[model samples]
Target: MPTPSAEAVLADSAGDAAFATTLAKGLVVLEAFEGAKLLGNMELSVRTGLPRPTVARLTHTLAELGYLTYDPRVAKYAVGARALRMLHPLLAGMPFRQLARPLMQDLAYSVRGTVSIGLLDGSSMVYVETARSGDVGPHTPDIGMPIPVVRTAMGRAAASMLPEAEAARLERQLEAADGAMWSGYRDLYRDGLRQCAERQFCTCFGDYMPAIHAIAAPLFRLRDRCFAINCGIPAFRLQQGQLEHEIGPRVRALAESIRVLVARPESAEPGSRGAKTQTR
Candidate 1:
């Protein structure tokens, strides 16, 4: 199956009357708040490619709906408490977090590294759960932190799970959207995806963050949603060979174990896989 271009997808969606353009634009206005403490209409317009008037209306609507808070004095908007209230339930509702945290903690302690589980959020991977070893150092994981999808092992692992055509389409879209940033690392990214397809895991060696290396594997759950788990260690502590040959398979096995745990019947045990743990 050939992947459709972004333009085609947008066009198709726009043509559908039930697609709710206004609602989509309102969501876009809310999303523009990511990583930003506050934004004015002009900045929001530029970020979302909506006209100033349209952005004003959208912001007004969002503010009315309690998704955003506006300050007339500063002429800026911030994420409202209502948004956090909505997010709290979603995070607390996921039963898998309770099931997965202990396993992640064990992995982190055994490998003396940071272990995390994440799901794709737009073009970034957002950490949903994390555990860190005592010696994890500066690379501590924070839940809800976003990592670029094209640059991290976890993101690559998720991408590798997509159909070949879809992956290619995504690569094309990324290149078109950010050619300068994408061009320098295109070959490396594609190679990582290929390796992930073959080995069921992906590796990053000081690619996204200097002096940090990680290995990641994809996990699938109900509703066809995909997630990724990664183990990250300082570059000085783990060499590239060790990351690939030693930690790669362990992380892959853990991911498979998590997948089985999620997909299995209620009576099944998640630890049946006997995932190997590293001792330092």
Candidate 2:
């Protein structure tokens, strides 16, 4: 799902009599800091659609709480160390990452592409683990990076695992939020999902990024959690045919291996043949 706009987030809480608007606004301020190194009061006000004075108050409170750091000289705010600390538990305890890292590494090495595992988060696929061979190109994203659902191979693969009704709901939501961009690529996105349903994998050729191509497969784990793994290669390095026929199937195999390992970790060690072996 696309990240909710600050207005939308606040609107959701507006109808509730006891909702904490202050806390919500403070969080929206923190979210505005995403992908940004520093934000001044005016920028935060513009992003959050809050008054500059309100933003200043929230920023000051957040700084005091260790969620944000204020640079007095520049009069800007940045994410604080406490926010990084808050993410440690989520990253450190993911069993899926522990089981999938070695397999992702091997796939990256074999295909000479960056490999990643992502989980559906709201309207985006958030990377949980990523691996890359020593290939010199194709910027590998850091963990926690969010990729839009309707524009990327991994996101499509993960979405394919959803029920038809849920998938349709998500598509409608995306179309509503991303109008022209979603309309332009809607056909390709549908085709990729159909391909994923047919072959258990999906391929994208420069759909999200102009010079990037990827093939991905969905993985299902315990408690109905779903994830996806993909191999991303630079367009110059891999042809469309290779992405569809070779890398696509290889990624599917890796995804299935991960599903098995996650389902029964006691039955397969991380680097053991049972976990690493491609089922076909």
Candidate 3:
């Protein structure tokens, strides 16, 4: 079955008269560029399940509003500076990213791996911040990259932080959407969640991608946002059991440190309580 367009889905599900279907459709067109540099109307239509003509009109409106730019040379649209500017506010709202940066960088160097922060994005876990040891590779997560919610250690650890009912609801949604994907990782997902519950961290070995191993722990927050930290090192870099014995505990501690820093009152300014916390 074809995925319905944003307009159709919203129309059916939304009872509120205040809902702006056209505005949503246009935003959906923009979201079609999630992992792409540029896209044409047809591509946007296919990606968003919106009609081509509708996509064309939406793209034109967005371009007019400075949210998108059109390159006549290739006849494609790219997200504009305005759209990038819009993201700045959202990024600014995450007060923890700044506090976690140095700590994550230190941990990445300590383990010869990459340390990243993951936040729930629908059914995916998106990296909102990252620090890494050396040259980047395909497996090294970058900010804005997303991984499966049930398929990576970071995702599993984050999911484990969810309330039981919320987690079960999400599980049902994912299973209903893609039974094959959910089934393939269901048991492993549960195992990872159990590990997080028991040890406050979970490890993924050669999952999410071949030859990539990672450990993650959730950063429990009072606010609604759920975040996790993942430290990923190539499988070859480890001998055996290093993920659990070394990396897991370090990641868990790092997460707790960050949680405290972010949760501190505004009056408790950095370095005011005492010396700055050192990651080393």
Top lDDT prediction, candidate number? 3
Q: What is the per-residue lDDT of model 3 for residues 87-121, given as tens digits with 9 covering 90 to 100?
A: 67878888779888999999988878899998776
Give the runs in model 3 whose Cα sits over 4 Å from its true position.
1-16, 264-280
Candidate 2 lDDT over residue span 172-251, tens digit each: 77786578879888888888777776787888887888778888876653333446788889889875488888888888
lDDT of 1 at 171: 76
| Prediction 2 TM-score vs. true | 0.87
Could you tell me how far off, in angstroms, the CA of residue 271 lies in candidate 2 after the best superposition?
A: 30
Worst 10 residues of 2 by lDDT: 271-280
Candidate 1 backbone collisions, by pair: none
Supply the TM-score for candidate 1. Answer: 0.79
Whole-model Cα lDDT of every candidate shown, in order: 0.73, 0.76, 0.77
Scored by Cα lDDT, where does model 1 land? 0.73
TM-score per prediction, in order, is 0.79, 0.87, 0.86
For TM-score, the strongest prediction is 2
- Ranking by lDDT, best first? 3, 2, 1
